[model samples]
Target chain A: MRLRGIAVVWGVLAVAAAAGLFRLKYEVIALEERLATLTHAIEADRRAIHVLRAEWSYFNDPDSLDKRVGAKLDLVPMDPAHIIALDALPFRPKPVGETAGGPARPPRVLNPGSAAPIPVPGQKPATLAEYTVMRTQP
Target chain B: MMPALLRSLVRRSSRRGAFLYPGAEIRDLPGAQGRHPARVRVSVEGQAKAAVEVGRNRLAITAGVFALAFCVIAGRLVDLMALNGGEAEAMAAAMAASDGPVVGAVVARSDIVDRNGVILATNLPTVNLYADTRAILDPEEAARRLVQLFPDMEYGETRDKLASGGHFVYLRRHLTPEQQEAVNLLGQPGLEFEPTERRVYPQGPLAAHVLGATSTDNHGIAGIESSFDRYLLEKAEPLQLSLDVRVQHAVRDVLLKAVDRFHAIAGAALVADVRTGEILALVSLPDYQPEAFSGAPADSRRNRATLGVYEMGSTFKLVNTALGLEVGGYHVTDGFDASHPLRMAGFTIHDDHAQARWLSIEEILVHSSNIGSAKMALAIGGDAQKAFLDRLGLLSPISLELPEVGKPLYPDPWRPINTVTISYGHGVAVTPVHMVNAVMPLVNGGWYRPATLLRQDPEAPPPGHQVVSARTSDTMRSLMRRVVTDGTGRKADVAGYLVGGKTGTAEKNEHGRYRHKALLPSFVAAFPMDDPRYVVLAMLDEPKGIPETHGFAAAGWNAAPTAGAMIARIAPILGVRPRGPETPVAPEVRFATASGDAGRAVH
Candidate 1:
């Protein structure tokens, strides 16, 4: 009876050991596959970066830019006399709103942060709506 | 019956006892039979009990050892999980990070441009091919195919390289796009294309000396490209230089023609905007193509405009006369006796084309009288001369954006003797750039704007320092105009333009002695003097006198004419309208001496 009991215990231990080892093997395989996938993705990214760097150099070539500019714009080559100082520019103001019948009004000096002028009695004031309407008409 | 059966059993036991003892007969061992049977039964029972006890002890020992080992392992696991869990996790993460794929290396490179938004130098992307030998399936076949595609590549070399067990090997660098495509179609495992920056110069050798070139690794090796290397590699915003390609080509073409005509040793030219101190064109002869820099001789790579310093003979007269009038309290009407050569320190200073008459300050400059210039320097004194030259950026290396600048060779003691020789541009040495920069204030209304490689911001006002009085500057402009129209620089005069300039012809110093055969001829000029805008200079090193030059290698013959041609071509490109000859020169000085006779003789 005792011998039989010992044999039974040995059998149970051997089966348990085999099961544990099988599970460990599968876990290792899964991790290895995951590592490989990550490596592949990273390598792809590296190749892309390399291609981009080369393209950058090609586009920046002076001849390339010159050709592109010539093709795209109506640019005439400029000389030193074509360049002038900013101070030398003639000062001119933009024209005011257009209307045939309306009387010419003095140009308004708009202070960036100042409050708008208050309307006085017996004076026709320009309201916000009127201003918007005037601006849309133009 | 029971006794008979017992007796039979006893007889059987007695027989077994007899065999065990080997001496007793069955009939004689009757009592021994019963006792032996009981003893045998007890022995058998005891043996069974011993075996059971041994098995139970062995099971208990195994269980004890197994439980102890399990406890130990569990304790270790707990310790690792609790006490060192964070560290273990960190270590694992570090390992994973290390194992992670490497990203491509990115390099920042510099940018180059012409003054007018023309791209001269730029960094572009290119593909470099590499291979993993270990990943190659058939090295021999791959090598054969590769050699077929690239005839330059040796089959044996490619095979040996592929056979090298290294994980990575560089097959080629800077492969063309078509080459890259061909390599890609091979579909060889472990082959890779790495991105790298390649510097490209679009204008080739047009402005090679000024623009410089970069090495294969995208390092600046020469010229502005090399000098501003750090700024370029930092991927800083594009540097817009003051160089105008149109003017640069004009200057280069004329100088190259002259170089070919004369077979001169070297030549250089510069065009600067006087108003803003902007350099429009700079050309050095014996130029190299930036792309194929290897083919150029070492001497051709040297930038003569900024790096080569020579005694700029009569050109120094411009600075001398300007300083003399400024420091000696002299006016255009101030007259100096030039009837005889001035002797000082055993050296006699005389005019090249001697007037042998008293000359006013303007006449002295017009005639380029060495004696008059030396006397004027003596009046100014040594300390004042030093201070004035230091102010003019002649006492030291010119401060320019480019790194290839030569130091001015001037006397250290600043003695009267040094002053006298320096006044006529004999003892002093300076680059053409220095001479041009020093002369700028004479025309730009007394303000001196330092030369720059950066583009000017139209909205922001340009920065400048006052180098001379506006009145003095106006006076110098008028004097320079006279030099062009009625004096030594008459050959430099441009039609429909009020041009003003000075000519210099100095012998080169060889073996500590001036070589009379070797001359440095230079011309510094500004056009439309009534409204000074640009200062242009042209120089020829060791120029030979040709028949066309009337067998003369003087600045007036070689450098002045070259400058005149450049101005004519570049002025139109720069959009400078040609002024009619009738346009009066500005800020005309009144002569205190009524020397109408002196003027005609001087001319």
Candidate 2:
């Protein structure tokens, strides 16, 4: 009886191993087919890209560009007299309010040394001023 | 172990002494330990039992070995065929064997690109449609269908091709994909498509002569294409030329305008980076579209920049003056008498608008005095002048990558008349490329770098040979600057840029005699003369005098202004800064007389 029992166990193990092997073999075959299809798709994409690049260059030809530029852009060739070195550029103008006799200037800090208290995460809000209301009627 | 068993069996049989009777049968006798000893003993007829036991033992051992080997082989076979993914390898092998059209065909010819990586020439994948006439069941039907699909193809020609009982015939080549599909829908028997490459010039006729043309099989036939055919085939990388399409267009536009405005036969222009010998732009007209190589006029196909040779008028005066000063050790202040026309060997050399006085070396170039240049050449012996020109690479064909270069024409005997006329730009003919390459040394610190079509790495320059002393080059630059400031090249002077050059207006020599009306006017110029960077050369063939030019057909009126326009457009592109200060001239290089229009914009 023991020998028969052992034989039954051995037969089950053998069947399971054979079944696993077949699953692996079919899986590999399917993967290889998928890989080949993907490779073919990639090659097709490359050919499309090549054709596009050639067409791009054809359209970007200088004569065509000159025509397109003339029609589309309001640009002209830079005259030599208009071109100047960096040294020739005028100094940057003062800020809007900082200009001489134009307007009052603001300090580097808008409100000098008046650091507001940090807001607590879960604190109840104090009553806001009329002008400092956070939200207004939509 | 089997051998031992066989030995025991023999020993027992022999001990029994069964051999006493030759044919007696031996049976098992009960031993002293009577535990069924008969069951363990064997009975045999005679010595045959021992022989049989030995044979059986050898057979058993052999069978065991073979059985083990077979088991091992079976295990390995199961490992490879069943356990591992061996099918993947098999599939890979099959895939490699199959010709997958999706992978596409390899490009047979590499691309030609400009310096900025712009594609000038490329290949387009196309199909050639052909027919197997022998397999055509209905030639009339196939031809009818073909004509319907491809309207460009004639019905009669298609029918003839299909009716001919040939194995194969080319119906149409370089078919577009849409056309191919239309033909395929016909389902005509014996019709086939062969995938091939067709060369394309994206820039069209912009650089036609430079990019060249290709054969039906996509092999290069001319220009840079033919020159590097093998190299382009072996390598996949694009060959980058030194040409800048922007600069080339600018030059071509300027030249075309001049050609059209002057009613000239044709024109040519070239721009070179004097420092690196890199050709930035070269234009030749009438230029043909590289794509439309057939049915082009022969004159349009000629690359005037490098192939067409002409006696380059007073452009040679720069050569005469430079050589006269450098080789003859003459000073820039030296004067040549131009009071009378030079008469030698039945030929007279005179100025166009004669100065009619003694002119300094600078004035000769300023006025373009043919007599003055002749006197200077006479002063420098014939041998010295020839040696100088030969050193300048004017005596032989210039070494360039193009195959269509022209050989320079010079007097074979090197007679006195040849020497005198050649001095004032005659008796010799050279391609414009040679003229530009020869004059490079004048502005390039007296070093002559061979003009190149390939882009040069500025850091790794080729060791060039010295063509003249640096001091002489300095003097030449000043003299050239003076020419633009006050002499024949006055119109070429751009504001805020130092322009220096000489103008030559040579009458075309037709059938061994000079034709006065048919003139070849050219201007050779160098810009920012203080430190020259580029040399611009412009030439107009048989330009007629227009009202704007004051009815004057000369280098000063047409070619000089063309060069000026080209310079004005290309300077900003080349990163040449225009200095604000007025260009100053040296005291000695100034005109001696308070010159009138004689040395001005007149040839």
Candidate 2 local Cα displacement, residue B506, angstroms:
1.2
Best by lDDT: 2
Please write out the lDDT profile of model 2 over residues A1-104, one tens digit for every residue: 99999999999987886787678767866886798799888777876776777898899887888778889999765556655443333345557656556566
Question: Candidate 2 - CAPRI tier?
Answer: incorrect
- lDDT for B122 in candidate 1 is 66
lDDT tens digits, residues B2-68, model 1? 3444565587666642343433332334664553533221222587789988999999999999999
Query: Where does model 2 exceed 4 Å of error?
Result: A1-35, A71-73, A90-138, B1-28, B36-106, B133-137, B165-167, B187-190, B581-603
State candidate 2's TM-score.
0.79
lDDT of 2 by residue, B181-296 (tens): 98889888899988988889988899988887887877788899899999788786789999999899889888988999999999999999888888999899999988777667
> Candidate 1: where are CA atoms >4 Å away?
A1-138, B1-107, B186-190, B292-295, B581-603
Worst lDDT 10-window in candidate 1 chain B: B585-594
DockQ of candidate model 2 = 0.16
Model 1, native contacts kept: 0.09
Alpha-carbon RMSD, candidate 1:
14.9
